[model samples]
Target: MLKLESLVFDNGFARLPEAYYSRVCPTPVPDPYLVCYSPQAAVLIDLDPAEMARPELVETLAGNRLLPGMDALAALYAGHQFGHYVPQLGDGRAILLGEVKNAAGEGWEVQLKGAGRTPYSRGGDGRAVLRSSIREFLCSEAMHALGIPTTRALAIVGSDHPVYREDVETAALVTRLAPSFVRFGSFEVFYYRNQIEPIRQLADYVIARYYPELAARAEPYAELLREVARRTAELMAQWQAVGFSHGVMNTDNMSILGLTLDYGPFGFLDAFDPGFVCNHSDSGGRYAFDQQPDVAAWNVTKLAQALVPLLSVETASAAIGDYPQQFGRAYIERMAAKFGLPPGGETVPLLMDTLQLLAQNRVDYTIFLRRLCDFDSTPGALNAPLRDLFPDRPAFDAWAARYAAALRQQDSADATRREAMRALNPKYILRNHLAEAAIRRAADHRDYSEIHRLHALLSRPYDEQPECEAYAAEPPDWAKRIEVSCSS
Candidate 1:
């Protein structure tokens, strides 16, 4: 055992009944090595910064050894995979070492991804590749910097051991910190099994830990479902605004806190295409870009069904019903911010219709939005910018006349709105081409400088970093149509 006293167990989920989790230690690996440790995570966890970089600390984090007082266990929860129910799916590869109350006094589950197999391993070897580990580290931090709630990565540890996939690769573990690892699938597992007491116990545990205010309500369980819907809608709206595609919308992958969790085969849209599908395995495009909002609602509806035992039929349906209106309001607000216009019913729909037209004409999503924010008082002034995103100048000129007329009716000055929109709209996104280039260099040449640079650039994506203007440009030729999938 490492050292238990220095360790604190605010053990939120562990407080739930025995069926919800399996108490198991991480099966240690061989020849563990440190890859990268985020000092920011150390600060978040309130661990000693110097100790976090220590060799022994790295070994413990890599699953080569156990930390002192670490009660590592794999959580048990089932989820719906692509709209199909998996009665028992849990942390196959990940092990929650324990919970720790950070300096802020907020409890966070500190888990080791790729730690080794647990009861939920499902006959497959529990391992993670270095590439995926690196992506998770960078993307988690990048999202957090972008003001999106997400599970944070404390460190990524690579081991000498190799694993087989399409090819042999080194193994790695990501130390993930989050308020809870419980998913929508977790609730689904017990409901499908008809385990009512465990469901109530788990719901109470969640309300106490994360949604404390809900505990005061007359019907905490029903209120919990509604609260989840509200948060999920807001989260989906944020994803839409940022042009992020989660790639996999499995119920197990959805965090209850409305934070982005899994980073497998995910991509940021470099060009605006509403139907953009990132996951190649998703042949039906069930989780396509435009379909995300609906998919999120669908997943939450499953959660609502699971909670029906604890909630009245009317309450459950009412919670589910709020999804459309909630998502609509949140999405419109986000879109309004992107265009620097205060949200109103009429202008928002007109903007949405205009977006559809642009999509039909194959407009560059980020570039078109950014350029529209910079137009002068007259329609003619925006011709060049509009034409750049359209097939021909005349096609854009006609659209620009209508767009300019709409803008002139607003009270905000064109310059002020432009400046405001610039703040809301990002100049840079983590484009697939750029990410691939960074990953390839790191894998082939052991160069992390480019990766580090890209991470920094994405941190403040909305700002115009004059020296880093090239980083804001769209992907070059040969980079489009690249397929990212759920496999890794």
Candidate 2:
């Protein structure tokens, strides 16, 4: 077994001023129980399985005990939620347990979400419900399996306690690891407070830790902002291509390393609805499915504004101006992969036109895209998984004709195209209906078999798992619009 010292402790960020974080320990919970464990995450952190799965270690993970050298602290940051500035929204429900290096020598932040309250609790119990914990755990693993950059979940620990939201629910904690938990909001806090020195130090630390290559540049802060913008745009593009709706694109939820974090009220589009809003608390559909790119652009502009003090006006403007074009290029490349076509200038408009048709016709997002993998010149041979998507065959025929014509010019063989399309198009997504089913099974019956099954299938989402075909189907009538709350 690899000992703890085998993993390095290069604590660069902790060397900064103490005001950036609050030195506090997790307020332990009672009678912690293991809910789930990630063998893959253990391998990444190189933790011994026997040690990690032990009851004592599980209790430590649940915030009921402290681990050796673990400096659990609540990080400080501010964020703009739904365009409303919340100047004091820090880690009200999370604690950064500590930092550790993996076998690959990469530093990762180990955080405990719902590990009890801290100084930043804001008068609320800093505990997480089992329902939300399950969703986050499954989705983090599912998103990673889909090849999207995201924070990985280490384990989940459940307790015999209850928390009140809409009703009483069992509480749990999730241990998640990431390269850095710093956010756009972290910089915003300093800029809002007019604390430029701390902002400068924060920028320098970010540049050194995440974008080390930029630290040597003449304008490292400007360069750092641009790197984050470019990476964030690409991440948003990837999300759109997969029909993902983050539900909450707040600045704090935005990772400095461009990872998907804070999975709350998130959903995958079953049907192609551009205006789909998964978050029930969002009275206004500000962060809809199609509006993610715009939200990302807006957030990057906010980041750019925060760094303006460190940059010349012209440099800031230039970096800001590149967002649209950069997002266009990145989004198109992902679309090309989805359609099994080589990426180029012409492919963009064609894909956009097809998307317009899909949105107009209200087609099933996953099924429509998945079927396109088998699209050929023989029009009538195409199979429709859901006939309601197109009222008649002629509508699909027209689009299929155009698509087939484009495919014919490709240099790649049909088999290769089909294989590539299958690889890019996921066979499974965390549809709200499916996620609800899994959560219900666990919460009501204490049966985690469905959760385990769904996890296994989602891990290989692009493959044809013949036995799991039912899991990929559309939601039932009742689940079509099940409301999801911010609390869970």
Best by lDDT: 2
* TM-scores vs. true structure, each candidate: 0.94, 0.96
Ten contiguous residues with the weakest lDDT in model 2? 3-12
Q: Could you tell me the lDDT of residue 419 within candidate 1?
A: 82
Please give the lDDT score at residue 450 for candidate 1. Answer: 74
Residue 13 of candidate 1: its Cα lDDT? 69
Tell me the tens digit of each residue's lDDT in model 1 across 369-472: 77777877574575575577777567667667766777777766887788888877778777777777777786777676777787778777878888998877
Query: Model 2: per-residue lDDT, tens digit, 1-488?
Result: 45543544444556689878887788788888787767777677777756665777787788877666677788889989999888878888999877887667777888899987888789989899889998999999999999999999988888868888788998889999888889999889888898899989998888877788998888887778778888898898889989989999999889878899899989888768889998998889999888899998999888888888888778987877788888888888888989877688567778988888887787778988777776664445464543346765676677777777777777556677888899988878888888888889989987777777777788899998989899877678989658886886
Report lDDT (Cα) of residue 474, candidate 2.
68
> What is the TM-score of candidate 2?
0.96
Screening candidate 2 with a backbone cut-off below 3 angstroms (N, C-alpha, C), the clashing residue pairs are none
Question: What's the CA RMSD for each of the models?
Answer: 2.5, 1.9
